[model samples]
Target: MTDGASRRLLTTRRSVLCGGLGTVAASAIGMPMGAPAVHAAGRVVKISMQRSSVLFTVLKVRGTLAERLAPLGFEPSWHLFTSVIEPMNAGAVDIHADVADAVPIFTQSAGAPLTFYARERGAPSAEAIIVPADSPIRTVADLRGRTVGVSRGSGSHYVLAAALKRSGLSFADIKPAYLQAPEGAAAFEKGSIDAWSIWDPFLAFAEAKRPVRTVADGTGLTSYHRYYLVNDRFVAEHPEVVSAVYEALSEAGRWVKANPEAAVALLAPVWGDLPPAVVAAANARRSYTVEPVERAQLGEQQDIADVFLEAKLIPRRIDATDVKIFRPSTVKG
Candidate 1:
C-alpha cells in the first residue's frame, strides 16, 4: 500500500470490547499480552490480533476472556491489527495475540519496547514459495531474475531468503514485490508476479481455489513459529493479568488442537467466509501449542535477524535474544 493508503487504514482500524465478538470493521490491528482479579470496572487491557492467527481469533470470538479477566480487576478491549510492530511501538496496544517469528526481529531493530510471552511450536509446512501451475520456475534457483511477491519482514520473507540460499542463490537474485497477502493474491492471480511467498490460510485458499504449485515450504528452511508479545510496561504493571492471559491462551491452543471440527466451524466465517475445508487445511499446518518463550528456543530468531541484516532488510545487526521474555508466575525462572 502507499503511505496514504496505510495512513487511512491505520486511522480506520477496528477495535472492540468483549461483547463485540463477530464484528468486522474496515481494517485491523495486531499487538502482544497479563494481570489479576481486582474488578477495576473500567480498566481495559488493549489487545491486538492478526486475522491469520486462528487460535487467538477463536479466543477473541469466544468472548470468554472478559469473564476470565473481570474478576482480576480488569476488562478487555480488543483491536484487530494487520501488523503489531507500529501499534506496539506507539503504545497503541498492550498485547499482541501472535505474529510470525521474523516479525519481532524487525520490531526489535526499530527499538520497540516489547517482550516475548508465548509462541506456537514450529510448523514448517505452514508457509511456502508458490508458482503458477504451468510456470517455467521449477526450483528455487529458477526464481532468479523473476518477480516474487512477499510481505516485507514477515516469516515468509525469511523462508524465501533461506530457500534461495540453500539453492545457492541470495535474496537479491529476485525482484521482490513487497505486498501483503490480499494484494499478493491478486498479483499472483493476474500473473503480475512470478511467485508468492505466503502462509496459511491464505496459502490454503490459493491452493484450494487457484492453480498454484508449491515450489518450496519451510520444511528445511524455517520452522515458522508464531509469537505472542506484550509491551514491557504492560507486563510490569499487570503481572497477574499477564499470567492469567498466558494460561488462557495456552488452554485455547490445547482446545483448538483437540477439537479440529469445532475449530474449523468457528474460524471459517472470520477468515473471510472461506470453506470449512480450507480452514481445516490451514489449521492442519499449524502447531497451536502455546508455551512460555525461552532463550533456547530463540536460536532461529538470531538466524533470522542475521539473515535480514545480510539481505539489507533491517537497518542493523541485532541479538534477537536481547529482548525480555515474560514468564508467568507459575513458570520457573
Candidate 2:
C-alpha cells in the first residue's frame, strides 16, 4: 500500500508535460480507460479536471472504474476545473488533466518545476480560432489587434501562438483574454470576445451551434495536441498504476473513435447547450492510438517554446526532454 507521504511524492514529481501520459499514465494493459480492476483491493486514485470532452475518462468514467477496481483498493475522486492546470500546481489533484499543447508549457514554464509522466497516444487534440459567422475576422491575419479569447496553455493558446506567428503576427498583435473554455465560448457568442482560440468539441460546438467561423485547427498550428500528465513522484512510486491508467486510456480512445455519435451523446449533457452538429464535426477528427511521443511532434512543441521565448509568452526556454518519464513495458495488465 502506498502511504500518504508516498502519494504526496507522486503528486509533486511524475507529472505530465514531457508528453503527459493521459493528463499523466494511469495503468494495466487492454483494460480500457482505468476501469476499476474486477477486484478492488489497493489504493484510492483521484483524477480531476474540467468536465470537458477531452478529459473524458476522469470526469465521466472514474466512478464506475472505482467500483471495478475495488479489489485493487482503487478508489476514485473526480475534481472539477474551469482551468485544467490549477489542480496540478496546488497539489490538490493527482493528474493535471488538459490538452497536449498545455503539456510543454506546463513543464517548461518559468513558474513550475516538475517531472512529467504520461500522455495520450493519438493525433493532437483538436483546436481552432473561431469568429461569429457574421463577423469579419475571415482569416488568421485578420485577427490582428482584435480581442482573441483563449485559456492560456490550453490547446487554443498554443494554436494561437503558432497561428499568430505564421500569420506574421506576435502575441502582441491580438488582444489576449485569458478565460476558460466555457467562458470563452459564452464570450464569443455574446460578442464579448472578438475571436476564440479553443479546441473541440467546443470549436465545433461554437461553429455549428453558435454560428462561429473556424479559421484554424490543431494541424493549422501543428502543436496543439492533447495529453495526459502526472507529477514525477507518482511515476516513481507507482509505475504499475501509471501503466494501468494508460491502458484504460488506450481503450477509451478506441471506444471514442469507434462510436463518435455515442461519444458526442455522452458529452452533450455535460457541455451545456452545446450543439450535436459541432460535436459530430469534432468527432470526425479525433484519433485514438496509444504510442510513444514522436519526434516531429516534440519539435513542434520545441518551436512553440522558442517562439514563446522570442515573444515573451513564456519567460525562458526549456528543453522538452528534461522531464520525461515513460516506460510502456513496465505496464501491468
Assess every candidate by TM-score. 0.87, 0.78
**Global CA lDDT of candidate 2, please?**
0.59
1-333: candidate 2 lDDT, tens digit per residue: 247655543442243211111122221111122222233456666665543435344225434345444555565555545555555565555555544655457655744434444455444446677788888889999998899898776666777888888889987788999986666766776788898887765666666655666777667456445566666666667666666666666667777777777777765534443456666676676665554444445666676677667777677777764556565444443
> How close to the true structure is residue 132 of candidate 1, measured as C-alpha lDDT?
85
Off by over 4 Å in 1: 1-40
lDDT of 1 by residue, 71-182 (tens): 8888777676655567766777888758898899888998998888888898989999999899989899999999999987789999998888889889778899988766
- The alpha-carbon root-mean-square deviation between model 2 and the true structure, to one decimal in Å, is 9.2
In the order shown, the candidates' Cα RMSDs to the true structure are: 6.7, 9.2
User: Deviation in angstroms for 263 in model 1?
Assistant: 0.7
